[model samples]
Target: MTQELSPCIRTVNVMRYVTPLREGGSMPAIVEADDDFMYVVKFRGAGQGIKALIAELIGGEIARALGLKIPEIVFANLDASLGRTEPDEEIQDLLKASVGLNLAVHYLSRAITYDPTVTTIEPLLASKVVWLDCLLTNVDRTARNTNMLMWNKELWLIDHGACLYFHHNWTNWEEQSKRPFVQVKDHVLLPQASELAAVDALFKPILTEERIRAIVGLVPSEWLTFNVENETAEERREVYIQFLLTRIANSAIFLNEAQHARQSLI
Candidate 1:
């Protein structure tokens, strides 16, 4: 949460707006954050608000917590006044034409999708991305499709808001019971895990208790849920945080390494 939320800090010189994503891109204004920034604007779309946005920011942060590379979240001023060129018109109408600060994301192309089994010099990077997905309990990266971005053969991971065991809640009990410990492990990540063991090393210092708490705290409460029905926002957030923490703690053998790293810093 060390990120600054200043309105005048920077202006996103939106490049060509990407067409609304068929799957999950429709709601947000996925425009480049600024001329120098690589990420794009992620606005509150149709169902835009606390619960839905909470799913996005928090879910993405959780992925980063588990040693995955993800786009950084930046708060930006996206009022109707700031205009360069419509990145993609289809997604434009879906946006609130109002001028105001919106949740903007850093663009990550390497984390974009790529064809699996494609030859590359840094195939190990691909393995790391997959392993990161597993640690997050991400079931989205199945054989059906993988999200990746390639640069110099290095692969990046993206779009995990629907992951972290979400499908478990929506699936039938019998099917859910058949799920793997970490769905990513069920794929080809395990056999090639050693190839990217070093990637785990990078996360050790970043996953400390304090660091994790800050991230969990930075998650805007409204994003967690809209009508708590019975509980307050704080109560719901604590409950959600506790659940996420349990999942992170049980994810993998390397988790201890990240934990120990966090402890030493404390």
Candidate 2:
């Protein structure tokens, strides 16, 4: 339950566009960077827009704070000229528009996707992951689309852009924060979780206001350009921090919902 500042997200320059990952609606691509590291770059110009990137930053960082394994995230600088070399018009447009700051997740070499039938997770880890998805109200981590990776025999969380859905409708985020996360029932790890209350007790105290603020602070100012309810970008950032603080303060509301989900699954 101790609070500590997370390391600042590193910034890198994209050197080469390797290939596009066409699996998801948002066309994230595998790109090589100046640091000699490969990354899965999430372009700001994608249909999902910059809000998705913000959610990925905040949600992924929060997951990291909760002791879950995730690839290192970085701010990738993309030059517009890199798009002209691509033949595909779609990718060309994406790259051209994403000529500034983009989000990139460090690629895990030879990592396998998590398959429930083949992989058995420990109860504590399962409970923690389920708890995290619930807290973030992430609806994408269901059985059909388990956004998890198995690398080096360890479970790693990924693709958290679908979280923090309240941001999409920022008119009443305060009320939305207090609302129960009803999507917990569909979480892929719900059946495997054996200790929901224990997970709550362990994480609730650790995610203090200071820690949440630090996580939100990691989001770049350019990505916070969306004006919600006439609030400026800086004001919108504070609102995000407040929404998270409210949700954690009312953690029991979502915890009870998750415990019920676990009971039904068991």
Candidate 3:
């Protein structure tokens, strides 16, 4: 696979420790940054580990490539000293451990959580979002936890730290790539997605190996250097690129599965 660089992801310095969003397991925080914007920061020291941040970078970028709406993703620079003022030991420890590069998602002001009853989505847009989630094996977009937000009357995707799950267990990831993502059935937008085949046709060609590699390339070496099953950091990065390439190559089976789900639901 070709290794070409994409536009560099912007990096920002965290200025203040805003309130922690405790609803989710990771306890991500809403903080103000040196850029004068508020961001929902996902720390590398979180229990989910750096691999989760890798997924966020790769998954969020791919969503953007597919013309889906997602908040701006940036590398958040945290200082260990920032934890000194916080009284909460948990947050203090988290801040200290994440004193380097972390993940920051631009916080959308006045954005409401997506409610199926309150808002309706265009069928084509819904299909595209569902297709992309399926391709990434994201199981976090279910009704109980639709990680989607509505801002300025447009739907925006978020919280992709739970995606690209195959990396959680690298063993036999090649075989896992071909497996159908059954979780697509529970996707909040699946019922409204009637054009699965069209979505497949439109996106399949766009997600070429080079494009996927470029997205993977956006991940920081620090995040990818974790020792996984004795594989070197570079080797682990290659594994991510290979897994995605395999998934794209075998997308027909996954697309068929999505179509079957849509047929049953719609």
Tell me the tens digit of each residue's lDDT in model 3 across 162-221: 999998887889888889999899999988888777988888888887787788888877
Sort by TM-score, top down from the best: 2, 3, 1
Cα lDDT of model 2 by residue, 1-266, tens digit: 23257658999999999999999788999999999999999999999989989999999999999889989999999997899899999999999989999999999999998999899899999999988888888999888999999999999999999999998988899999998899999988889888888999999888988889889988877678744345567887898899999988888999999888778877
- The lDDT for every candidate, in the order shown, is 0.50, 0.90, 0.87
Clashing pairs in 2: none
Quote each prediction's TM-score.
0.62, 0.96, 0.95
Query: Cα RMSD for candidate 3?
Result: 2.6
Candidate No. with top TM-score: 2
lDDT of 1 by residue, 123-218 (tens): 455545554554555556654656555555555555555554542353343333233343444443333444444555554344555555666676
Model 1 ranges off by over 4 Å? 1-19, 23-29, 32-38, 46-52, 62-68, 80-93, 97-102, 108-112, 120-128, 165-182, 185-191, 194-206, 252-266
Query: Which residue runs of candidate 3 sit more than 4 Å off their true CA positions?
Result: 1-5
User: Stretches of candidate 2 above 4 Å error?
Assistant: 1-4, 227-229
Candidate 2 has a TM-score of 0.96
